[model samples]
Target: MIEIDELLQQEAWRFWDQSLSGKSKSALESFAADDLLCHLVGQGQSPATVRTWVHDQTVVLGIQDHRLPFVDDAQDFLRTQGFTPIVRNSGGLAVVLDAGVLNISIVLSELVQPIDISAGYEVMLEFVRLLLPEAEGKIEAYEIVGSYCPGSYDLSIDGKKFAGISQRRLRKGIAVQIYLCIDGSGSERAELIRQFYDIGVQGEDTKFTYPDIKPEVMASINELLGTSFTIQDIVIRIQQLLQHLTPKVISQSITEDEVALYQFYMQRVLDRNKKMLEK
Candidate 1:
């Protein structure tokens, strides 16, 4: 695992805003570096970066998702319903994103030692448990059956999954990211994935395996806490915990060099998308 001190001092954190922060061209102009590696909260992140923004009503889809038997139909349904269908350049299937979910990025620089993907995930999960010790037992780290984006590190409570992780490597950087559905109805999010699978697969037996999503096996942190807790609230907690781990947890934005790199990366991401469409 890359030490916290090293991460704090490295150009990775100082370079880019992972994916979410590099929203616009200008934002990218200031927040990306040649070494910026992205770990998406869903499938893959590396080389450039993987970012999972917890925006409201956004449904992230895996590459195979674009190949749904009724691809256009599903896309139209999502579009009409105000859900943007974004094809991800990583592993895994469809997953939900919302304000209630806490999206985390494990940005990496190519200059650093190569850490195993599973190790990167463990580090992020450890940070979560460290940040919120009260929910130690409640925060289970195991694959929940019948969940979209099922993985070994799925964060769940009482057999309910609330988080799914993915990674993205680009150029030479890496971003390992995860989005945890906190403080809301996990079942609702699960139901969304369920519908996506139902509408996309339609009982097809392809080489890939799509999850038979179970909405009941998911719950929000709020419900688990028996109190109302927002993602922003948890963000503060995360910042505080990180501050404790280091003396200078500065809140600095990205630099111009990073932004230029982000533009290049954005183009690459777009190009990648174009290729998929062509196929």
Candidate 2:
């Protein structure tokens, strides 16, 4: 069995792609052996294979959105805005992204201990904290009431949510992914989610408790830090953490096998999107 140390010691593969490619997800899923852990920095999924490239003009909807009363109208709205609307299988509600947002993923194989959920979350939390240690104790994990995609694991500082984490597992492979609003106005994104819910829900009371979505509750790490936080800065921080940790890290390209796994994952994504559209 490959030890966790050996797994963490390996430098994470950073793929910079402008297009949403199956190869990226394949690398995270099939490329890794059963014991090797996987992480997708910006993919927004655990065991989530693809590092879905959400461009600036993209509007990502959550699964619950299919039931929306004005679904077609919402789709038309998206088209009018030149936003490519797509459905993501993860749990969060609608979230917008562009060049300013930083997405991360951590891939790890499920081990005997059963990778800790909080541990995985904290790993990303700690990863971000390492970037700006001054906010070490300040980075908090709690549902920021009224924030879009509000969850118990929302990462924030001084009451503003800046990042959210989710996990997915495929076979023995696990991928932990997160998106950080590093430079843009975080509240604006929150407001965007608020609008999505407003349109999707159409004021109907449903069993699902959608986030109240207070736009003011979220902000970018840069704004919260009083310094401009750039994706480039975060990229360096991730590399640094791997170097500083006890696990010796080695960065490498995805192998052929992982590519095969991603193909299946991509098919699932495509199928899911198709079913959602049919609804």
Candidate 3:
């Protein structure tokens, strides 16, 4: 396990917006930025970065989701609900993204030592633990069986899930990502995925067993914590946490080089998603 003490020793950079509104960066752009930064960090050109992002009314689907029997219907249903459907390159099933949801990505380089899957997940878990100190023993990592994007690293309180963690590795760099449901109703979000899978699969018998989603199994952080924590509040908490961990936590901005690299990664993801959706 990589300890927090060891993580603090590395160079850290923070890239986040203090306000939650008007974030125009698409989900694809955010993923590309992570990949670009990963390569930069792997080459020792940039420090480890903690980035926060949010997208409005989008449902990010996994590759398996594109394989659904009635995927076209699912995408149409999502569109009818005023949500844009996007096929993500990373791992995970369908997940909702909106202003109420905040995503955090911890991009690190494994130049010195390799980061195993468990260790990569632990890093994100530890950061979440630090951010929500109030939920000390309540925050547990286990698969919420009925929730959308159910995974072994699902961050939940009691039996209701509020966040899910996923990782993407490239060029000796890793991005441990988590989407925290800060406000709004998590069950409502789950209901969206439930409806999506319900329509997408149409009860067809396939090799993949789509989750029989129970919206009640999901809750937002504010609901679980019994406090009104906004997207900005958590973002500030994360910034403070990173600043406390390192002496020189700087705010990072996109560079021309990163922009060029981002174009490459973005096109790759776009092409992959295009191919998957076309199937």
Candidate 4:
């Protein structure tokens, strides 16, 4: 496994905090932004980047989610519950994102050497441990059964998951993204996804097995660690952590050229999502 320090041994690191970019910046844009960053980083046009983002009430669905028997009804249920439903251009089942969830994407270039998928996940897991030294040994990475978007890289404590890691590789760049439930009741969030699956599947078995969500297995970091931390507090921690890792931490937004690329990626994501939801 490539150590986190080894990954951060670069000359400089780019940092972008879009957590408070307002409600206009949807979660859809966040995924698109990562896609753009991945292309630039992979092409050696931009340094490795760490972007933090948060969205309002939203349920980011996976590709498989769009295949639910009654997906339209499930999405409508989400809308009636005051949450915007959008299919993410990545791998993972549905996940709840709101003001309290802090999403961090570490974009790395693999132009010179290929990165194994597990290595990418390991790097992000180690980085998360560094961010919260308080929960050093307690943070365990394993599949938390009965949790929404259950994966082998589920970040959990005492069997309750607080985060899940997903990866997107494009144009020789890898975007390792993790959404941390920083605040609120994790079980409540899990329950929402449980309901979504219930409505979408309608108890009908399918070729692809969906998770039988057990809300008790889900929790926020605050709930797991017994600490009161906000998204802003974690943002500061991320900056400090990166500053220690690299000599220079550049706090900049996307350039004009990047904006043009972002638009292209955004349209792709928008189009893909429109097609999925329309089904």
Best by TM-score: 4
Query: lDDT tens digits, residues 154-223, model 2?
Result: 8989999888887766545566667788787887777666766677678777877766778888899889
Q: Model 1: per-residue lDDT, tens digit, 1-279?
A: 566445433332221222344332222221233224342211223222223334566777778887778767677777777666667555677877655766666566554466666666766777677767778767778889898788888888778777776665554445667777777788887877777777777787777777788888888777776767766677667666655655444454444544665566667666666676565
Clashes of 2: 33
In model 3, the worst 10-residue window by lDDT is 14-23
Candidate number with the higher TM-score (3 or 4):
4
Task: Report the C-alpha lDDT of model 3 over 17-100, residue by residue, as the tens digit.
Answer: 523533565687777877877887776778888888889899999988988999999999999999999898656899999989
Please tell me which predicted candidate would have the highest lDDT against the true structure: 4
State each model's CA lDDT, in order.
0.62, 0.62, 0.85, 0.91
Which model, 2 or 4, shows the larger lDDT?
Answer: 4
Q: Locate the minimum summed-lDDT window of 10 residues in model 2.
A: 26-35
TM-score on alpha carbons, each prediction? 0.81, 0.78, 0.95, 0.97
In order of listing, the candidates' clash counts read: 35, 33, 0, 0
Which sequence of candidate numbers ranks them by lDDT, best first? 4, 3, 1, 2
